[model samples]
Target: MTMTFIIVYVVIALILVGLVNLFMSKRKRKMKTQRTEQTLSENDTSHQSYQSKFNIRDTDETSEANDANAISEENGKLNISNNSDETEALTSDQNAVTQHEESHTQEEEINEKLKQKHSAFMFGKGTSQGKVLIAMIFGMFIAILNQTLLNVALPKINTDFNISANTGQWLMTGFMLVNGILIPISAFLFNKYSYRKLFLVAMTLFTLGSLVCGISGSFTIMMVGRVLQAIGAGILMPLGTNVFMTIFPPEKRGAAMGTLGIAMILAPAIGPTLSGYIVENYHWNIMFYGMFIIGLISLAIAYIWFRVYQVTTNPKADIPGIIFSTIGFGSLLYGFSEAGNNSWTAPSVVITLLLGVVFIVAFVIRELTMRVPMLNLEVLKYSGFTLTTIINMIVTMSLFGGMILLPLYLQNLRGFTPLQSGLLLLPGALIMGFMGPIAGRLLDTIGIKPLALIGTGIMTYATWELTKLNMNTTYSHLMVIYIIRSFGMSFIMMPIMTAGMNSLPQRLISHGNALSNTLRQLAGSIGTALLVTVMSTQTTQYVSTYSQDLDKTNPFIKDRLQEMAQAMGGEQMATQKILEFVQKLASINGVNSAFLVATALSALAFILSLFLRGKEHYISKE
Candidate 1:
């Protein structure tokens, strides 16, 4: 059909535009690098530049006696007694210049020492933040990987458990439900306990969960394991972020978040591919076994590394806030997760969704009225946090849309093996891992607006290209587009999130992190439901149109039927084949439609990102 050609033309149209946008992003990074060099050069030539980075104040009492010669030169040119001491004055000026250079060198040395001392790795080489960050990244990577690894193994799990798809899905839904409940509660936990204690609890729970899942024989037992994993994982992510915010200065947080983003990007990227291999060859339970062992290692490292950087305050527990948060977020996420399998209008779906909204409203009111809120609703008052949150939610939905659709297109319609399908995403994932830290540094140097703008711009163009998917679309084409999409995403998620956190005062970072993660979690589920709904809705229309054309009245159908009939040996076989082809085409059309919706969302995110204030908007760190 002529519709198949639409995909080709769309790809062609987008390639040049995508290239142009990517080139502009590259140019911006270069420009930012050059500015950094120029600033360094200026700092070397002038003492005034030291005021900002090194805090060189003019207060005489605070001045270093070792550097007094440099200051004396500036105090009316050393007050030389006419021509009698002209030679002496010249010598004094030379001495003053040397002292200035030495003072600058000393400042640089102190900065370098601080940088090394705070580094994130430890073989006894770094301090609390760096060691803890490394351990958290390791633990978080495995936790995220465990989720994706389970996705690839779910079908196998269903067969083994002799359960229906709906029953099997409980494994994932349960994990998410626990995560949602725990995430909001994390802010309260952070307020009440030291991070060292939280890290121990989180890692212990996760490692234990992995062991339970690996060894459990019954479905009920496995569900228990999943809940444990969720409890551990839910706390780990937000707690890791909160610790980073506490330990690192505001100016450096972009890079720190970016460093954390490496695990975030790589785990999901590598998981499916790795899981596909393991699932294809080995028993499914082996994954949990591996996760269990790795979890123990992570647990041990995190325990040794995480430190209590600050004392915890005991905020009075908001028991009512706790109930509302759990009920509201849990019900809402559950409803969204179910909507794709059972239509949105299903009675159960509608009831839960309505309940979720009502409870969420009640929860918000309770938080607002409370003296010390459980989740800190007041963080939304900052315009920067609010704007980025909306944009983050939108982009997250679009991201989940792409992530879901591409694999379905690859393995279902295209009939690629799971390994092949996952490997296609690996390149993009690896690239994103590489770019994560770079994007963060750029965010620090150039700010969030540029990174967000360029990221969303590329995402918009790339997703727009995916809307052209058809039965005839090539595997390579899908992979290329997906890679471009991943590249754009690396620049967006962590940087935008860090920008939102930076908007809040120091005390509220944990709450902001909690809210951001919780909503994004909700957004991911809602996006999955909505995009899948769009696909199925479009599939129905296309199927109807296609079914109508399958009648003998259509000449194109006549020719196709005749060709298939001669090749396959019977009219019945030919008709059946055509019907199969029609269904496949209709499904492919649905995927394209989903991507189109994603493209529009990306465009809207780009527009909203344009309004996100840069690093200049950040509250100064305490």
Candidate 2:
């Protein structure tokens, strides 16, 4: 189908979905109002019962007192000594007091029971809780899937738009930048809005963004769509975790959380392969269309099954803290991204990097002093969390570096089709997804230290192998190495994260998770930018060296150029071919050099893994 037709179809679908959701919401609101009225009526009836009982008791006490007084007056008027009557009146008064006390106690007990019942009814254990969770997971899966679905298509996008690689990298970097900025705000959003409301808004934004992307004819519009999608995605990510934490009690949380982890892992795992196949065989717009449809379905399900499980309180946002965080993260991302296009020594790069550092430091200070910080930097105080975060950041950088560079190497250097390139990584992605839960199980059975050691060892070996990639490298060879690397990654991410979180007090666990998530996003962005910059710089250097050598009085080079000129029918065509060959050769060598750097990063992460303490140490803190 044509892009226009597909975009139109998606827009229609979104409109229909929006209309249905609006109708459903209105109906739901009406139902809620009716339920509230019924509940108020029940409470009023209960209150009236208590009032009636008090009123009757008071009347009885008044009648008894009047009778006692009348009897005393009669006794006095008759001048009759009646000790029995006096004793009876005293006993009657005691009985009345006792009865009144008993009635009041009964009223209080009944009221307490009513309150317990009302609470249980209002926050009743949902029969469809499992369905609700499934709906949420589905939504979260699609949102996260969109995050990486375009990674493999970036090169194609650059070619189609005639944009430079540096400009194209923003497709990834910009998405991460938006995510990094929005994730911290999620705590405030969750506190201020109902989960159901936040979810609807998030899904709506995502669906709308997908439609915009599907229809976008320009890079700027595409980026705008991506940013909007990121906003929704950022909200949904933490929203999923928050929902799970609220719905499941502590004992059942492990299994629920494991399922959540599966969604997170599996989405990105399959994204490239899916994007590859689509981009290869179909229009890239189809990817957005598919996501839009999935998002629409998820929204419908959410309308039917999603419930607010936690009470929300109005929480004030940390405005200064938010501004500082944005400046810090945004500037850092901008600096790194620009470094790919401009030299590292460029004034823009230097100034932005400095500003990023300064602002981040100031943000740290502000968070430390604030009564309610946006990010809760205090979680870093826990030794295990700090260690795990450092390791996680390094691993994240390495992972993102590979994710971006591999596509370039496969497509640009190796001349693989997008589909072929995506297929090359499919096995590894599947293996990673399969290994995630197994690693979690292992974390439960064994611990983090052993897993970290083995996983990091495997990762280091695979990354070292990657550094040796060249034109002659076979696809099967790459696949095997990637599978091993992915398996290693599965072992490293969850075990270390679980171990670190385990070390934290219950109160700090959420903050630790947030911190971990933010750092991962930042690491990915910085890593992609840094690696791309290195590759670009190295490529330029290699091209310069080749050009200078070509200008020298080398007989072999002269003979090759002359033969090429005769074969191509003229010096003009020959010169063009030589230039093309030089560019290609430089690009391959540059990518190889970039991989070498990635290898060094992997080595550093491996060394850090060695310091990971046993689970016993982290668990002891809890």
Candidate 3:
């Protein structure tokens, strides 16, 4: 009965969000259209006057050329009479020629004007571009929210399906792998199809995938649903970014991208907590039902209001480039994800990593030589873009490290329930969401460098504080630190990304957005794997050392063991209780060691932030 109530509550919440989003979108569109029409009406007289003047100048030039030709034909014989047959014939010929030229020129002008109008309509120059952007944000919000929503439910899924941890992990690994494969191709899709068409297809896939997952009766069916959902998610992120970049100019992009960050960052931030609550109270499949309903609403909204904001072009796909990228990025993501579960030295891990590197190198070479590359490598020529991408990757690595490690520390060692751990992190996510737009506005007005320095400094300090956490650390204390870290992250993420993309040319914006999204995904996987491996290795060593000390027969160790036994109510339970306590201590020690590594990563990002140039540098270059 409780589970039914929770499901109904979640469904109601999704319906409310969807209805509110749709109403706001329609209202904004109406206002924008009215404003654009008024502005165009106000400029109508001046626009006509300018065109008339241009037409007069063209006519004068044409007349002068006709007169010169007449003089040449007469050849010094001045025919001044008005009624002569030859003069009449010459006048008639000139009139006919002038009429033909004027007709052709007028037709050309009309065609040019029509083309401009079409472009304006497609790009939302004076219409409801904001509405389109909002709709896209809403659609992307649903897609990204789905990415991490199932994470907390994975354990429940495993128990229900009776699968091993390794097998269950494919739910995440498969999603990411499909995402990696599809993101690179989005640039081509953006060029090849209208925005409305692409958006509809993406949302349709997402809605269908969610429905499949919600009703699935087998693990195989569930995996299929996840893959379908990944295909949609992979496109939605880059698609929304490309649209955002298309509508906003570079100077204003910081704030615009910041608004986009609300969906990008907040969705993932809230996912775990939201998922935990639902999974703890209800069945795992209920989460999918909620997603399916939300996705259906998002798709309907998109179909109704999403305008084509960019013109489509005819660009053929580079088959070779696609193959290399699939092998390269796909292998790398898989290898890192595996490293968290399998030893780094395992044959599968080593072979996949080596193959990934080799293919990536080959892909780079092929892109450089291709006339039309799948992923634009030429964007790397801009030093600002290059630097910003590197910094973004490093920061993403550090962020993912904390996200994965904190849960382990809280749940495994501290014995917190999944819902409790999720709730602990919820406040930080809320803070980050609130700060996103504010940071973006600051980025546009104040600049990225100062914000980045201040943000990274706070983040580094917060990460360092986390390293001091032990078994006795208070929950409130951890929450405070996480909140500070989230605040810092809000300033650094979107602003830095906006600054990098600002350095690129208009023609390369799609490619630039695609590349940034792809690499950030890779960095998250790699960072999580690297930190998890470090923690595992360190925990093993710590446990071995503690076990050896316990065997020494020292008085302190013996007394402590006996005390734990007594607490468990008998000497018979002493060995088991003592070993469990020691193992918990070792886990805490290992997590601390891993956080130290995270602190180092945060410090590195801070140092790199110092090198980041201001927005003025990019503006001046432009």
Candidate 2 C-alpha lDDT tens digits along 531-601: 88878889999999999988626888878878988998987898889898899889988887887787777
Encode model 3's per-residue lDDT on 1-622: one tens digit a residue. Answer: 2223223322432343244335435544665566567657745754676568668866875787688678656754775444465576678678867876786687578657754554442543344767776888899988999988988999889899888877788788778877887787678767766567678877877888898999988888898798778877887889888887777777678788888898988898788888988987898899888988988888777766786654345566576677777777877888888888788998777877898899889989998888888778788888778888898898899899999999999998888988888888888888887888899889888888888888888988999899887889999999999999999999998888888888888778788888998999999998999889888999899999989988637888778778877788887698877778889888888888888888888899889888887667654254
Candidate 3 colliding pairs: none
- Record all residue pairs in model 2 with backbone atoms less than 3 Å apart, i.e. clashing: none
A best-first ranking of the candidates according to their lDDT comes to: 1, 3, 2
- Candidate-wise lDDT, in order: 0.80, 0.76, 0.80
Q: Which stretches in model 2 have alpha-carbon errors above 4 Å?
A: 1-133, 151-174, 215-224, 245-258, 544-552, 559-566, 570-579, 619-622
TM-score for each model: 0.79, 0.75, 0.83
Model 1 C-alpha lDDT per residue in residues 93-195, reported as the tens digit of each score:
5775676677779878866764444322223334456777788799889988877888889999988888888778888877877787778878887876567
Model 3, poorest ten-residue lDDT window? Answer: 1-10
**TM-score, model 2 to reference:** 0.75
